[model samples]
Target: MPFADSLSSRSPQIPCSRRQALFGAGAFLGLAACGQPHLDAGEGILRVIGPWDLGGFDPTKSGAMFSRLQIAETLIESDNAGTPLPGLATGWTTSPDGLVWTFRLRPAVLFHDGSTLNAAHTAWALRRAMEPPATLSLAPVADITSQGDDMVIIRLTKPFAPLLHLLSHTSTQIWAPAAFGPNGDVRNVIASGPYRLTRFEPPLRMDTAFFAGHRGGPRSVKGSAYMTVSRMETRTLIAEGRQADLIYSIDAPSARHILADSRNQIIAAQMPRTLILKVNSGNPKLADLRVRRAISLAIDRQGIASGILLDPSLAAGQLFPPMLQGWHDPDLPPLGRNVEQAGDLLSQAGWLREGDGIRRRDDQSLHITLKTYSDRAELPVLAAALQEQLRLVGIAVEVQINNSSDIPLSHRDKTVELALVARNYANFVDPTISVIQDFGRGGGDFGATGWVNRPVEQAIDDLLTHGDPDGRRRRGIAQVLQAELPVIPISWYMERVALSDRVAGGVSFDPYERTLRIADVRLAGGRS
Candidate 1:
């Protein structure tokens, strides 16, 4: 099937003490405008603006920033296709039984702190990542040890194929021993990457400079600056005014505006991300599979893709998008809109239409609260559209726009009825890593809540250990998700970025959005 058809077919309120710090001055301001040309060759600095802020220094919590800035390195990395590539580890080998893996470290690499990259440091970083709060520890890792000063060994409880891919994640980023405090806390973030962090202000701005001792040598750009801008309009303004050289997470409308301007360039690539509605199946009203399917059938994915997203081809028919080749099941029937069927299913599930048009079972009404945030720009708009669509089927939805943390907090407390989120399935190149986190035995914060299927869990485990070559087990998992409607797949996504013409060389967009490739970026013309 053609790629297009494949996709088409188918506030939380902190205390008073936190208020002053979060809303302080200089928090939302863009960097000072350079008096020189936008891209001064002599003073090579790439200014960037994005939706996410510098939450902290912990790789496990805020690794995306570190990874994107090239201020940190992971033992493994992934290519565009999600295949494992080399990073800190030059190469790796596994034993015959596949339980023990050995990685050969690259030589002569130096951390930003002037510490040499060695096996002991690599092992310490990996071990730290496997501790609590770091999801990497969730993997079947049994132990970690170093061989001499150049090799690191990882012993796994079983043969897990996604281990390498998991290492590529930001959580497993290697840091120097000095980066941690006496108690092993992440007091600093010194690492061996192309860039080194010079200044960091939590939740807002970060500054970095090219590392002289970097393995790839000094970058053409002497330094770079990153600022967190929550408003999409502000990001567009910076891109258009050339106040910033690069801007990420552009909405469809902003993308169109940027594309029309000659001074800016828009780069977009289909990503392995799916916009989904996480459902709490434990709710008495949502406990029935038929009711869940009714809600899924009520969604007009085609309309949302074409009308809201302005990209009809992005309509998702399954949980996994076409970008994830193996997990996307071409054989399954495409998800379609059927209002009559949906109403009938709800009726069969003990819902009766009242005079006000709202369905009800006994004295309870078919009312649900959907939690979403506005940072992404599209999410709140999508939530409004979803509210309208669900109302058509005798369902009344109350949309709550809150902090991104609220969704997970609600999920943990089992109070969330529905949540709209953009789930990235390519965090590890392999879908299994995200799959296990979101849909494993116990439901995940962004995954299912109060929904469990033993067979589905077993299938995911089988894929992790045996590898889904034919994708039979993968299809099975998708089938299970489709039938149960633990999460409703709304639309696939395309990552969009706006670049100023001042950037001489082109910037590479990682489908996973892991790296910004600032090192390769230089002034449009030669040195001034």
Candidate 2:
């Protein structure tokens, strides 16, 4: 049952009238006037605007870049409904022993450079992903080889039930062999997706054009331009003024404002994420289970969810949200604020409240730095709220808002006392992969403090190696791990996407907030 065994694994559009006419503008513009934007020659190009900066074209490094994701297609893909479907590997089957998997590549599929999709090329991508000097966070393959012209076989040291889900991540996306240099470094950046990257601007914007020769032939979308505008007001203005065809990463207040406007239509969906505090359980002051339980009891999740989040449904009753149907236990006792009880627990633990309103044990004040990042636009606010909440229970907390990478950096340095983060459990459609990275051994960027649980590890391994599709046993194992206080989840997150009336069909929201069905979207005016 070792944790390693865990199964698992844009806005905007400008109307280009001339471009439309060249394609079919005269006919499509009439329909485009209906606020639908023409899908033919007369229609306009899609201008997408959002908050995620395009770090780079590297799929492993820059997750928010539509430029990268649009070009790179992974082995598996998921819809907004959270169902796992085929991607580059059109079909796959697992060995009865559960240690090997065979993937049947899509025939007639070609990369941007017109390279045929073959087993050898697919194997090259897999092998390159496993090699060092490249950090494709979700690479789980121990080895990969071509079985035939269209079949690629992957070998695993142990069974990983969530393997497919991991493959669905953009970080593990498949790129053409020529895309990388001899050292496995990304060079040409050629991908086999429905769209090809035409231009890339670091940490900001990207432009892509439809790959008509794509296996699926661009599905529904013709072409798209993605922009990274970190400022919320900018995205809002663009959406409202009809400058942007689509937008995302809006805060609750901004979302309400947009939804309130009659002209703009906003779509809000439940994101598979949580606002949780990762406690360093190994710290002497927090090592006691009673202390962790007491801290959990001292917070008012309902108040935070309703008052701060402006969404009462986000108040998390358990570590795992209800959306995670299998791993969440409906029967677990709800953690609620009870200051008196918390005080009593603290007193019993030999901690006494000082005159300054901070708990003291053995001459040490109960003060800790709660680290957070502002990339999400809400973590800092939540951290401030948590600061006041914890203070009510005699715990003094200092909030330090740093860059997103600092959380993992601090964790590695062991300087992090408590880290407030928004963890996305649906990154791979299965919770086990996250469980392993976050809770196993030394803990990943968003897991427990200097704490390790052997029993939880074994349970996860068992579920990965032998659990059934029924998922009950795996659920039980996840619940046991949560009950151990490895990570404390306070509120769940819901995904939100903002769209303009002109943008059509290209809009689908996923739990992880990833752009998966980009092909389904096209310019309002007909120009595909």
Candidate 3:
């Protein structure tokens, strides 16, 4: 049978296991136990389960936990639409040339160590972030100095517009001076957010207590615990057993099963993340634009989104999702499946169909290796779907499931042929920052490998310095990417959260995945 015909006859099924079934059943029993719960506010501590683990104490390395738990603060904050908002710095101003920026610190703020947060501490943190092993140093910074006890001044080598957004990143999170050792290394995790670290377990668990001295006042919840559970089944069991108050990144099927129980609430929001196929444009066979477009045309994004993800709306029409204001162009041509068109494009690219239906040019077979990881549950499944879809178009794809680090490692070593990854565009509020980081000069590990578009690079440079809120320049960049197919976007992302009814107060979901909003949570039924 022809590959296309065989694939058409069979329906795509989401792979499941016995463990999933057992844990899914356990989730129902856990939900049932919540009905009789009347635990006092002091007796209950909010428990959180998520995939992110505490890598280390360095703000440049593992400060995401501190930021998410509100144990640290950055110089700037962002709104839902990626606009700059007030944070540790109440307000900021820039010089006419945009080279000099001044930030006014929030008054009377106390760190977890009881030291007042001042401009000197902030300047030291910024300087540390701009040093070795810290990714924040990639920003266009000239100098960081303190004006007084409550003000910080920054000088830029050039007019970098994403400076504020870069400051808002987790790596730039400010720490107390006491947190560092004599060598300027981060020896402790002292910070100035609403929560203070009380217990620290490297890479697995952390316990924190609400800080009374926080400038925002005490949080509604007295204390909280975070546990890193890599297995989806274990996380589901924890959520079902009511041992955990909140769980992040639940699978679509597990979410559906848990949502059947009224005691549990599933809060899902669209995030500015894209499931993309990172191609090695440097490869001999893939360097051709026709071959790249053909491979992209072979993907059934709608099928994968609707079948595996259980949400057809998640199908990506363009490189940028709708959440990214100006970058997502509605008028751009949408990516669609066309087997005949894919075959013709391959023929035009000099790929001849062989006896076994695999395409060949000269002695090289139309074969490629796809690298993906199992950390994100959907990725492997999506890789399988993509492999079969590409086979139908006479392109033989071998899917290699490996560690998440392998993708970037292979990219650096020039061993990556194709990689499937979830790229977060709003890491710094401004999508252009991530765009430049990924697609600029040498090409990012998660972006284009062997190709560079001068127009896209120039537009990104302009967007960073001049800003492009109107999106005219952003549209051109997107158009260039669409035409070049440096990275093929398959689906947008939906962040899933499971909250038990025992917890009250609202959870604010940041589309950027910056903060977890644990401070706002309180015991249900007004127990506080």
- Best candidate, TM-score-wise? 3
Against the true structure, whose lDDT is highest?
3
Q: Judged by lDDT relative to the true structure, which candidate is superior, 1 or 3?
A: 3
List the lowest-lDDT window of 10 residues for candidate 2: 1-10
In the range 1-528, model 1's lDDT, one tens digit per residue, is 102111110001112234433342223332333232232223677788888778877898889899998899888888778888888899999999889999999888898889888998789888888887686776789999999999999999998878888888888899998999988788888998889998898787788888888868656677788878887776766666666777888777666655555545666667889999999999998999988889889999999999888788789998998878788988888888999999999999999899999999998999999999987889999999999999999999999999989989999999999999989887666788788888997789889999989998999888878888887898889988988889999999977777766676556767777888888776664321
Regions of candidate 2 where Cα sits further than 4 Å from its true position? 1-44, 63-69, 79-83, 132-142, 218-220, 522-528
Question: Local distance difference test, per candidate?
Answer: 0.82, 0.70, 0.83
**Cα error of candidate 3 at position 101, Å:** 0.6
Listed in order, each prediction's TM-score against the native is 0.90, 0.86, 0.92
CA shift at 449, candidate 3, in angstroms? Answer: 0.4
Candidate 1 stretches with Cα past 4 Å from truth are 1-42, 526-528
TM-score, model 1 to reference: 0.90
Displacement of residue 16 (Cα, Å) in model 3 is 5.9
Per-residue C-alpha lDDT of model 3 across residues 488-523, encoded as one tens digit per residue: 999999887777776774476887788887877766
Better of 1 and 2 by TM-score: 1
Stretch of 10 with least lDDT, candidate 3: 1-10
